[model samples]
Target: MLTAPIERMLFGLSDDHVIVEPHSGQLMHPEALVAFQRLSADARDAGFDPQVVSGFRNFDRQRTIWNRKARGERPLLDSSGEPLDTGALSDREIVYAILRWSALPGGSRHHWGTDFDVVDRAAMSDNYQPQLTPQEVCDEGIFGPFHCWLDKRIAAGESYGLFRPYAEDRGGIAPERWHLSYAPAARELQDFLTAARLRDLVHKSDLALGETVCEDMDAIFERFVRVPERCYPQENT
Candidate 1:
């Protein structure tokens, strides 16, 4: 039941498809907000305050992050979440490096309003800034116990409809334990989104490495954009 209007929201190009969630002032698909509230309530009962790090991001915001990273204005991290020197890297290599942690504009799931990066506010110091890296979720990391709690929730079928798209690294996008995609809506978008459509969108945008991204659109879609069918809530249930 994807409408022409709804499809517009899939590529981070439209603002009409989402509304502001009052509690967090985060823009999201209405259905996702409801489900997220349920998940948050449950997590709070367990002493975890589910704070959203990123919600719905538009193409412009994504592009700024990409272009900045490409110009060395922002830090680019490797697969291990360590900083890499990109001064001598080619534009194509820089594009791939950025994709390891950031999604290309119009290809990102954050555009869909059904996915977001989150952290447990209960574990953060007053001034703590979440890096959303694997190191932060390691056994000894500050957010380790929070992610462990999330693991248990997802495993016990208690995380509402939330699931990790990059739960396991399959050599595509690096694993992100902090990113949660709402299965009901996100699954539909994932299925309906075609590489051809994405190519058209990327070609229209002003990306940092526009030429390189256009040439490698299919590979990007298959590796960075497409998550396996195994990453759904039922698997957890």
Candidate 2:
């Protein structure tokens, strides 16, 4: 297994790399939080409003989401957003189904506090439901303008060092248009994490799907955690 200190930071179990900056509903990384503030301010000036919906989730929180989906408490979906019948699946199949939309507990970037989900405040009411579907980020959806503005910022080098990790369907996970990652820190963490370390850590855990995750560590690391280095911003590349 990897060293404890490194593992702690990687899994977001320690606060060594982050500060408790209030954002959305939880604390966030100081650096990422500053960047997000600037970006949000810019967006507001342009007649758009972006609000964080999630940030800095810990291991237990991730486990709850994972366990719920694995046990069919939450709806699992295919790449096309069709409901999956978890009752018909083996434990292994259920693990994969959950991974299609959720990350293994320790492997989620939310642990690092440098990643978060956002919504356009202009498009939502007090009763607005959060489906977080890709269709909702399309040109016709309420958040369409927000994402379009983000794209233009990325293309013009105006984004405050944020980018999408799952910008497309990569076969291992679904496309989550709402998720934004701080490139500088996220890239460093992503590069340092290895399949061996991730597998070893997860295999040693008591999670219900631990064995299933370790069963194909290579593919999971490749598809879920490690994107092509080139896909990241210049610093990561």
Candidate 3:
């Protein structure tokens, strides 16, 4: 996706990726931002204050997350949301554990500026930080009812072109109900990011467990990176 040696607009590498929006001052595709604004407005009208906690993340940022978890600087959580003992695990094992929660640097859908990790403003106290766990987004969790509301909105096709790509757990990443994607803009980027292209980028990166990751590149792309085709209705049209 990098168009030039010095050019870094794609994947939040350059400053151009970040534009100021009234609610979220993060990086975003123009169309995605528009849809998000509408989505937020609609949520507000429905008595919820939806806020975007995370938006477009750059390659270096994603790499830092991967490397830190790999080197034991950060905690690697399992499918059940418990921390793993990275000290005793193989590099390959650590890689998989990290991929369970996070994406590879170049393989993240957030690179397209069309995805968001959102939470309900009314659901949290001033000091509460969203853990983004399944527990937090389940029926009894803080954002659970909010997401259930979203589920209905998306089902009814009133989500302002947004949908939850990670709403289903398919043995790769866990279900992330808080993750919202602007399908139209995201769909184009998703098609542009092929396993071969991502493998090439990962190989050239300074990511931790580089070789171990490349070994299962195809499966990684299919499992951790690519979401269900149903999320992209534009693809069928």
Candidate 4:
């Protein structure tokens, strides 16, 4: 394994001007920063002026979200305030749901500060709800214009090095159609963020679990978490 010191992976926010929120962790990587700026600009051009609803998050924030979900303090879809029956779910199921709702902290691509959740800014003030569904954006009618703008900007010829890591295949993760990855450091960051490490972290955390949690965790890792990094290749060419 081409091991890099874990400490070397540590980085901080690039700018103080950007609005930082509880779950919106520090912004990292110049390419991603530019990509986001362009995304915001493109949204404005499309007459939406979408803002980043969520971004980089740490393990603590992730845990808080997960705990809230378990306590039925939030909704499964939007901010519905209905907690999920975590006791009925296996560890793997819980982890999978958690990933769909929030990343596993250290295992999150956002932790690298390269992935962001872009949302319609106007819709947020209405009720702090998501403006578009996953299907709505995937279709070429609702969020298609924004998608087209993002696609054009992230093409191989773009200087920003932004690429859609989860655009095509669902890959078991949530179909975050708006999420984008900055390739320059994304591959290394992905390698550093692995399923094994994430599982270990979950085991060490205060996650509530049912009787089948361990087995569910084993299955989840085998099925989704342990998949090889074929999509994210090494930083070559």
Cα lDDT of model 1 by residue, 23-74, tens digit = 6788887877887888889888888888877899998899899889988999
* CA error at residue 133 for candidate 4, angstroms: 2.5
Candidate 4 per-residue C-alpha lDDT over 194-232 given as tens digits, one digit per residue, 9 for 90 to 100: 445555556666755422334455555444443245544
CA-only RMSD, every prediction: 2.1, 2.2, 2.5, 5.8
Off by over 4 Å in 3: 1-12, 15-18, 233-237
Mark the regions of model 4 whose C-alpha exceeds 4 Å error after superposition: 1-26, 38-50, 75-95, 120-132, 140-142, 169-171, 210-237
Candidates 1 and 4, the one with greater TM-score: 1
For model 2, how does the per-residue alpha-carbon lDDT over 181-229 read when each residue is reduced to its tens digit? 8898888778778889888777776677788888888888888878676
TM-score of 2: 0.91
1-237, model 3: which lDDT tens digit per residue? 446532354344554655555675667767778888888888888888988888888889999988998888989888888878777898878888998898888878787778888899888999999887788888899998888898888887888888888877788887888888888877766766777877877788898889989889999889898877865544311
Give the TM-score of each candidate.
0.91, 0.91, 0.91, 0.65
Q: Residue 190 of model 1: what lDDT?
A: 82
Q: How many clashing pairs does model 1 include?
A: 0
